[model samples]
Target: MSDVGALGDPALEDALTGLARRRTVLVASDLDGALAEFTRDPADTVPAPGAMLALRGLARLPGTSVAVVSGRDAATLAELTGVRPGDPVALVGSHGAESSVAGVTAQRLDDGQRALLDELTTTVAELIERHRGARLERKRAAVAVHTRGLSDDAEQAALEEAVGLGEGRDDVRVLRGKSVVELSVSHADKGSALLALARVVGAESVFYSGDDVTDEDAFRVLPAADGHVTVKVGDGGTAAEHRVPSVGALVVVVRRLLALRSDLAPGAR
Candidate 1:
């Protein structure tokens, strides 16, 4: 990889330039902590000031596509991102269990999966009741136990108990994230969802950015090639090729990409 960092990486610009020339390109990102700062209450999160605008602008460009892949369910992801029906940007939620993009559908639960989800919900709800500040978030295909507002000891206790719910269960997929643990009934993940999206859109290149451990699934699947720009926002080890310190820094990088692509479009001399 290039020695340049994410904020002002000339190599990143080079990658963007190549993508602009490609027949199709996909610009996608995770919602929480990547586009928006993490809020104690997930419902209150919103994208950085011009994050959505830049994404929307990129989507409108010729041969370009943009999508948001989030852990939130499709409807809630749209609501939090200010994405309305008919919006150009596509959406994938529930860590790829749900989708609003063309040619991609949400995960369908069978009777067994539904029953498993219900059990997970009940267990997580009980954990929340005992954890005081912890909360349980119900999703379309998964149930998450969030410890964002809990004290240090309480958060640890809640996470430990929540994780135990998935132990010895071959059917359950347990995903641990920052201050949260999710137990999913479906086997879907961001990597598979992202690849499916790329195929449907016929994208020759893809740029994806994310901030959480769950996002590692997407990063690991994206080849470390020139046009496949993978970025990690915030800290911790990542499979992403580049790293940005904050959501604001990531926004700047995206806007830079938008400007570069715009310059290449057919127009005045």
Candidate 2:
């Protein structure tokens, strides 16, 4: 795993500098492990000091856009991040199944999809009941089984059981992330959401970051040759071209980019 020193690498700084100079650019990141450190209780998670402030500042720059694209539901993401309605920093949640971006419509479940989600919710609740420390998080088009506090054995058991819930079901999409398994009736992913957001904002390049396996979808879709910057927050094999050791390191990167971009135009800072 790369250490925090990775932030000082000239290549990364050059990439960020180039990205800042784009005619239009999108700065997007995942909330949980990218902007915020993981908390014992998910509800307790908040952005690292000055992280959101930097993102909001970047959003105010000419031809620049900022977004928090996460697996969280839209309303909870908004409430937790303190981003109000019509805020410049866009929020895409439910792994792209939900959104607070102006031109992107919210997701609605059809009768069949709703029925499948309801059934999955009941089954997951029963499974969680059997596993002492497991928790269930319900979303607009999905349910997540959290095993954060479980023992190694218990966590494995709970995750296996959760994965089993989608077996033999083509209609279900199962995503396994750090001590959590999510089942969604919708197929939307971070890659699609990022692409759509870029199109809507007319972004010529993007800077995206995340620390989960699901974030790989977004990473794979970003082309490094296009001056797009993709960062992985922690230790793991990733499709992202650059790596920052922790949320704090990521905050440094954002602040640096904000400063560089601000320097591009007078009185913008």
Candidate 3:
């Protein structure tokens, strides 16, 4: 980790350079707050500054692969990221219930779990509807209670309600992100996603980038290989091997990876 500071570090390049050797490299990144920002402006949606270009450049690299692992569902991810379905890039959406890559399976909810999901979604939907600012993001397999621009009390109420909704389900897990309460059927963690994706690319080296609480699941599970570089954006206690201050920093690291990609066929990155 040389001279890269809080935004990124030298260790990332070391890991990326090694990844250039693989027959294929898999790079997984969280979409919102990582690849793009949440906003009303269509053009401003991608991560600030040159982030989009940086990621696009990385994807252009030969023998390197890209995956957008996001909480948002696959359809939404494709619409936002402009990755058409069946595109080379893999997508892990709805926690892990859906992966765009072939041969990958996600945890499926049983009938009992489905009933509980219906209950929770209905409960939160009704409760949040009373508030002017709250929004109910129904992900089916997972439910999110969002307090987007709501008052402090509303946020707290949502959290409390989510905790109540998650009652008595040892199989289900509730994770709190920067501004939302996420309840997903405990099929897979981000770490499991990373490990599984690594095999798909047969990556000898790994680089993981994300922001928020769920990302710790991936950071903590990085293989013990020296070439693995785990990057965490913003402030948090993460198991990542390195830290970058924000998504903008992640763009720089992607640029470095673009440079590191070895000679291979076009359209293979």
For TM-score, the strongest prediction is: 2
TM-score of each: 0.95, 0.96, 0.84
RMSD (Å) of each candidate, 1 decimal: 1.9, 1.7, 3.5
Better of 1 and 3 by lDDT: 1
lDDT tens digits, residue span 3-111, model 1:
3344567766777677666778899999899999999988789899999999999999888889999888899999999899899999999988888886887789999
Worst 10 residues of 3 by lDDT: 1-10
Off by over 4 Å in 2: 1-6, 265-269
Model 3 per-residue lDDT tens digits across residues 44-137: 3455576556556656566566788877766766776777855666778876667787667766778988887787777778777766566677
- The lDDT leader among the candidates is 2
> Candidate 1, which ten residues in sequence have the lowest lDDT sum?
1-10
What lDDT, from 0 to 1, does candidate 2 have? 0.89
Off by over 4 Å in 1: 1-6, 265-269
Screening candidate 2 with a backbone cut-off below 3 angstroms (N, C-alpha, C), the clashing residue pairs are: none
Worst 10 residues of 2 by lDDT: 1-10
lDDT of 1 at 79: 91
